[model samples]
Target: MSLRTRFTEELKAAMRAGDSARVSTLRMITAKLKDTDIAARKAPTDPGVSEEQIVAMLRAMAKSRAESVALYRQGNREELAAKEEAEIAVIESFLPQQLDEAAMAAAIDAAVAETGAASIKDMGKVMAALKAKHAAVLDMAKAGPMVKARLGG
Candidate 1:
């Protein structure tokens, strides 16, 4: 199923299950998607945001909430931190499973090989290849250091 359809169905299910946090989070996602769709409509031929874009959006949302979690913790607001964490969990439920260390390393190796990345200068090529193939699963922030090290940076 398309990510949008899944979100809609899941939202209904969350509502049926009386999951207030999940319902709220999913509603936020839908709102974000609607805004994205409207922005995409500037080009008449645009088909709206793709699945990859949706996943990217979700990832951004999760990252923002994670930062909120950190800030809340630093401010000694455990309750707010926990709430942000809960929202992150709900957002992540729609994302693909993240690659573990070994898998991520393998993916990076494959991307490097595929791109024939010879040095740190080729890091952009390698990273682009990885993003094209593993945008949803790989954490680019963590992958950057590994990619640099592998390229002898």
Candidate 2:
């Protein structure tokens, strides 16, 4: 099913099951998606956003919550940290499974080879190749340092 449709169905189910946290998280996702769509509507002829853009937005939402979780924990706010963690879980449910360390390494190696990226100067090209092939599953934050190290930066 389309991600938008899945979100709507899951939202309804959460409402029916009285899952307050899930319902709230789902509502927040839908609202953010609506805002993103609106922002993309520069002209009547424009399609608001593509599925890939929606996935990117979801990833951003999850990443933001992850950062919030870390900050809350550092501040000794266990309750808030747990809340953010829960939101991250909800957001990640819609994302593709993330690559583990081994898979990530392999992907980076392949990207480097694919782009003929032999040095740190070619990091951007390698990164672009990885993004093109694995945008949904790859964590660019983690991948950046790995790529740099691989290139002997």
For model 1, residues 51-152, the per-residue Cα lDDT tens digits are 988888899999999999999999999999999999999999899999999999999999999999999999999999999999989999999999999999
RMSD of 1: 1.4
Off by over 4 Å in 1: 43-46
Query: What is residue 52's positional error in candidate 1, in angstroms?
Result: 0.4
- Off-target runs (Cα >4 Å) in candidate 2 are 45-47
lDDT of 2 by residue, 3-91 (tens): 99999999999999999999999999999998999998988787668899999999889889988988999999999999999999999
- At residue 50, candidate 2 shows an lDDT of 89
Question: What does each candidate score in C-alpha RMSD?
Answer: 1.4, 1.3
Question: Could you tell me which residue pairs clash in candidate 2?
Answer: none
Report the CA-based lDDT of candidate 1 relative to the real structure.
0.94
Worst 10 residues of 2 by lDDT: 42-51
